[model samples]
Target: MALRLSLLLLLAILPCIVHPISAAANGRALAESVDAAFWLYEAWPRSQKPARARAPNGFAHHLRLGMGTPPLNSTFVFDTVGALPWAQCQPCVHCLPQEGAIYNPLKSTSFVNLTCPSAGGTGCPYNFSYGGDAFTSGYLATETLTVFGRSFKNITFGCGTLNQGYYDNVAGALGLGRGNLSVPNQLGVDTFGYCFAPRATFFFFGSPPQLVPNTIAATTPIVENPALPSGYFVRLVSVTVGPTSIDVPAASDLLIDSKSPFTFLEPATYALVREALVAQLKPLKEASSAACGAVGLDLCFEADNSTNATPPEVTLRFDGDANLMVSEYLVEMSSRRLLCLAMLPSSKGSFPVLGRRVLMGTPVIYDLAKNVISFQPVDCATFGATFAR
Candidate 1:
């Protein structure tokens, strides 16, 4: 369910000094207002067979929102690493089959096509390409975006005429990255947060509530590298598995991305982590070898009951005192009684990525103005209570 609530109780009287908005003049008051808040809803990731036919367990998480004048509601994959929001538009040259009706701009009275020079220059076109040969090309436009009972007018978005990718049953995606065109930026908010849970993932577009007392909150500075400016970059100092702590290379950088389902580490780092985990799980060697073959996971083991299995604790230590922990088993084999590691080697020279698996049940707060990201462990089932005044 989508709910629109104020940020007054969440951030108005918070102890920390809230950052001021640096966007356009119209957004200045919005940034200072304690009443500012955006609607948040539950998002879930699902498994689907892409063109390659390889079914990775949980691929992506999506949230549903209402758009246009009459409110054409659709499901959108929540991509924290992506920039702009785009939906399948009418007069498509080629489009994938969607679950609901593809958005028709003609049907919306508030839809306006943004043309040349005025809207980011000449035709105002945009194209986004993802890994695995998936891409979407379209033009820029403004439309009224409505979530819950609140309405945002003249919000900039992409109206895709051609879209092709492994979108599952969703209409399009909602980008929540650091780019100027991202949802949080469009809303003129310097902060946004989310709590990922197996059942229901909660997202907030304004200032998030302070960390609950006694919660394991850790804050770290976000790296400001010009080469990779969009995504959230966190410096990884080391990783700990069980009793062994593996120091990461000085040049290694870790990106926290929600789009990627599984965590990825550089080849050398992954090897070290793998070796450490293998040594820690030596008692289940025989069962792991058998389950690896059956489930196609690199590190797998047969477990009579996965819930009761005592998995080794894994911690990712950032540059500061921030340490994100992942307890319990990482992966669960649905077709069989097995559990596997949910991390893999990064593609060649790519930087390491901290994905959804390691972030489950963790409430992550992205402070844009302060250039810091805070993390805390919490009971995700009850995390939504913070949204209630």
Candidate 2:
């Protein structure tokens, strides 16, 4: 059903392989052509299921990495909106429970506390907030970060001594945001791309390989909002539900985020989308709030009469005439006999977000140097099999 898929988007993480072109060898440049790839996995599958249906402010995707001198395997949630890469360190004042042992600085031979860059700070202290009560604070440090079999020495990362909120599954977070301290910016990666497939997503950083050669790629400009500098904003012209073209406010833009599980729209935009969808499915009775709330979703309908009912097709039209036609926004729960829309209204009726539900099975590229994002529809199963490692 659509509900499960949307929630699952907030329940998985990824594994990465760092391809180091050169590393402390023959006086050559270290990590000269550093291109990284990650193997994706569901974060909270049956075996790793949490007591709750979903985590607060869902950061479902996770990544695996090795840090320190002898190499300590660590788990991290890959967040596109987060501003810093941090891990729960030993001597923790207060930290959330996570799988595997926490990183111990004393045990690492290569660990070094970095000097604080900004004023009013003695050491390289960091405090990153991900809205609400979720926050992590610690001193910045450098370590030998390894992925797969390759290692990148002296990679800057946060050694969090204090962390709070919904991190029971991950050791910490890997920030893929646009901040200067983010992984991409710190590693000097010009381009990165994600090929999101079920169970096995692919992430390529630094000069991504050509993913969709023959397909019609939807290319859009990555608009920069001074208000939200770290977001990957795209110019959204309109959202088309079936044949109805719902015009979006010109000032409104869409954020391409990986952390969120479902898409969110402004109040007016959400109302329009919900109304348009309901009109198309008049035969089905609207589901009660209790039923939808059980799965932490909004806009659901009971589907007892219709056996072969199909969800309405939704398309996102961007400024460059790029259209992303969604095929499965309406997910049906066979047991519960309910069909639900995967999108929701923004918390503050603020900005709209394009979450992982819409981005699944799509090859999306983020060319930071060029300030563009490109995506194309493809059979991700076939793509994963071809590029499986």
Candidate 3:
């Protein structure tokens, strides 16, 4: 099991939900190690099959990894992390605020809503899906991408395939193969035009579909998030590694995922500010009235700037380590407004989930039984590198 969480452990790991509050669970999250999922070929469950177990069969994505060692050799590691998962539990379904929405992160950070197209309403627009029945839950997938190295966490880009998607979960996608995040939707090239990140040469899923104006009106920004602690939707609210672990009270009981990414806060001016924010986490410790309201004040993650050719949007970065986390801006979905961040703990050894930030923008198909996730990035052509298992 990647990281087992027994039911009893749930209470300790998951802070039990009180009216508008999130409960705290107890227990050291079970930890185990498996070879990086992306390093393997033959999809997943099938690879686990006795058949293609010999070599990392599909390591043909060398070109997609980068233009030789120039970019690869220049690998610079930083510290930070971000979101994921699936299921049809009530907690996961939330309505995204569409217009004139007052986003008070302290009281209520965001919203969620699930409307299956077949059921007759708006399904989640983004491919970030939790478990749900096909009739109501939507789609589920576990996708894996075999890149040359672990240089980047989750490299975002538009693929001529799928509907020019977005990267929500990082290593989660790599372990899970790509497919219909929500059942009715399939992110084939026909849907998403060629994906693109301007000025940046690489788009992990390859060139994306053409850019059409997002229907979301500039004035009416729709915010999508399942910020409630109910049913099965659990917000990976914050990850504060290395810093508060010892000083914080009974902090060890918290469910710090194994192989989880670490956002190393290098001591810079930005680091100093992040240190202050660490002290103020008291209000955000739970989804209390003030915490809900404080959501809007989460300046630790984003900034408002408009130097780019396109209109502005929100982006995320380290609280104080701005210089190190700066490059992450290129892959940020928007750069003008604000984004959200949860405190994640630090990791000693780098794993796929910990090293890379965002993997595929498209949601994936995670066949638990098969133990493999496959994604058709544009075409199989982008796949390179040689794999021997």
Highest lDDT among the candidates is held by which one? 1
lDDT of 1 by residue, 115-135 (tens): 654343445666676656688
Candidate 3 per-residue C-alpha lDDT over 177-202 given as tens digits, one digit per residue, 9 for 90 to 100: 22211110111111111111111112
Question: Considering summed lDDT, which 10 consecutive residues are worst modelled in model 3?
Answer: 22-31
lDDT of 2: 0.67
Comparing 1 with 2 on TM-score, the higher-scoring candidate is: 1
Local distance difference test, each candidate: 0.69, 0.67, 0.22
Candidates in order, TM-scores: namely: 0.83, 0.82, 0.20
**Which portions of model 2 show Cα errors greater than 4 Å?**
1-31, 35-59, 117-122, 214-216, 303-306, 331-337, 385-389
TM-score of 3: 0.20
The candidate 2 region of ten consecutive residues with least summed lDDT is 1-10
Consecutive 10-residue window with the lowest summed lDDT within model 1: 1-10
RMSD (Å) of each candidate, 1 decimal: 8.7, 8.4, 20.8
